[model samples]
Target: MSTVLAAVGAVHPLAAATVNDNTPWVGPGMMGFLIVVVIGLVTWFLGKSMTKQLRKLDAGRAEQQEAEGEEEAEAAAPAPAHDPKLNGAH
Candidate 1:
């Protein structure tokens, strides 16, 4: 068993040498890098678009809240309910 294992180990380098950079598998390996780069660019663009949309939504909500606050302030602060006999307006 030891002799057979040693023989296989000795032939491993020779077997690996038979395949060069020009092998068919190299093309798909190169395509893997391209696919990663393409996906990264797509994700970056998508994140940018989503961030812009969220910012716009936040600004709209802030404006709506500010307007509603103004209306509530107006309604809650009306003419003072003073004693009519004291003011002589009764």
Candidate 2:
């Protein structure tokens, strides 16, 4: 296995060897571009998801506030229950 690997490494040049030695920036530039594209996609998707969640939270909050308002209105109304012990009629 070691001999085979040595022969292969000695005979086959790397794919990059075909490019000009003076052109050092090409590989690094392509990697940077790919990184930026991936980051941009992630940021865009995250922003869209966050906005959707925020809208849902706002809607839920509004519904809760409306229900609380209705409960507050009920609290101010008079109670009409009559107890027999309080009226000395038991």
Candidate 3:
């Protein structure tokens, strides 16, 4: 245990010499903030574009459905019966 203690004591000075208090520590600054803002703006724009496209798609589908309903109603209706009296044929 004494030898282990002596070894640890010898290494402490080397460890203390490697550390410098004068060097500055830097964090995520303006560039990081700009990147995050750009990402948020891109996401917002994409969402708006997707909503516009979905609205257009819904409008087209409604128009198509209306046209199909009209066609079906026309095809289902029967023709009027012929009337000779009304035509003045006796």
Candidate 4:
């Protein structure tokens, strides 16, 4: 174990590789820009579709609520009164 430790300690650290200053550094070119544009357009279309769907859902819910309100009103209204004479009750 001590011999292994000594051997490990004797090893020197490697130096980093050098880069050429003459070479130009290239970045993400036209392809990256096209990809971003496509993604943006797709996202915009999806958002529009989602908005349309949500509006439909909201309209349906409103109609359902209106129908329920009418039903409740009908249930709560008082019935027509009957005359005693009409039923032969004097």
Candidate 5:
């Protein structure tokens, strides 16, 4: 099995050479950290912009509903008649 693996490595230049048991794998370095930070900032700004747009849409819908309600109320009610006798104005 080991010989077969060694032969495979010899045949492929891109294959891993030898496994290191000395040090354990660690986290990303400065470049990777900066990339992650940039991605997070971009995501945060996009989310904020989306929230603002949603709030605007909600406000517009609320105003439209209020206007529709006023129209309905006006259509349902009848105008009152004026009486000068009740007002004591001969």
Candidate 6:
């Protein structure tokens, strides 16, 4: 059994080093910075797009309101003519 174990250990010597090696790993601060940067970029792009859409919607609404106002003014009935002599006739 000892000879068999020695033979296996000799065949794969770096396996033990790979498991025991403690190389410098990433810290929480770096991870947090990456996450914040990604989120901020996404928010900036989304805000720009949302503002553009809102402005377009406002412009369309304004145009529609102006057209409706013109239609209403055109459809309105004209006021009757006033006569100064009719005021004393009553």
Predicted model with the maximum TM-score = 4
Looking at model 1, the pairs that clash are none
TM-score of each: 0.57, 0.57, 0.63, 0.68, 0.61, 0.53
Stretches > 4 Å off in candidate 3 = 1-24, 82-90
Q: Which candidate, 2 or 6, would have the higher TM-score against the true structure?
A: 2
Question: Which pairs clash (backbone N, Cα, C closer than 3 Å) in model 3?
Answer: none
TM accuracy, model 3: 0.63
How does model 2 fare in lDDT?
0.81
**Which candidate should be chosen as best, given lDDT against the real structure?**
5
lDDT tens digits by residue: candidate 6, 16-62: 55545589765778789999999999999999999999999999999
Clashes of each: 0, 0, 0, 0, 0, 0
A best-first ranking of the candidates according to their TM-score comes to 4, 3, 5, 1, 2, 6
Per-model C-alpha RMSD: 6.5, 7.9, 7.1, 8.0, 5.9, 9.2
Better of 1 and 4 by TM-score: 4
Candidate 3 per-residue C-alpha lDDT over 1-90 given as tens digits, one digit per residue, 9 for 90 to 100:
556555655889554434523577787899999999999999999999999999999999999999999999999999788999999997
Report residue 68 deviation for candidate 2 (angstroms). 0.1
lDDT of 4 by residue, 8-88 (tens): 555732211112134677888999999999999999999999999999999999999999999999999998898898889
Screening candidate 5 with a backbone cut-off below 3 angstroms (N, C-alpha, C), the clashing residue pairs are none
**lDDT of each residue in 1-90, candidate 5, tens digit only:** 777767777887455354423467778889899999999999999999999999999999999999999999999898889989999999
The 10-residue segment with the lowest total lDDT in model 4: 12-21
Better of 3 and 5 by TM-score: 3
- Order of candidates by lDDT, top first? 5, 3, 6, 1, 2, 4
State the weakest 10-residue window (summed lDDT) of model 1.
15-24
Report the lDDT of model 2 for residue 23.
58
List model 2 lDDT by residue over 1-90, tens digit each. 556655655677552343324654656577899999999999999999999999999999999999999999899878878989899995
The residue pairs that clash in candidate 6, if any, are none
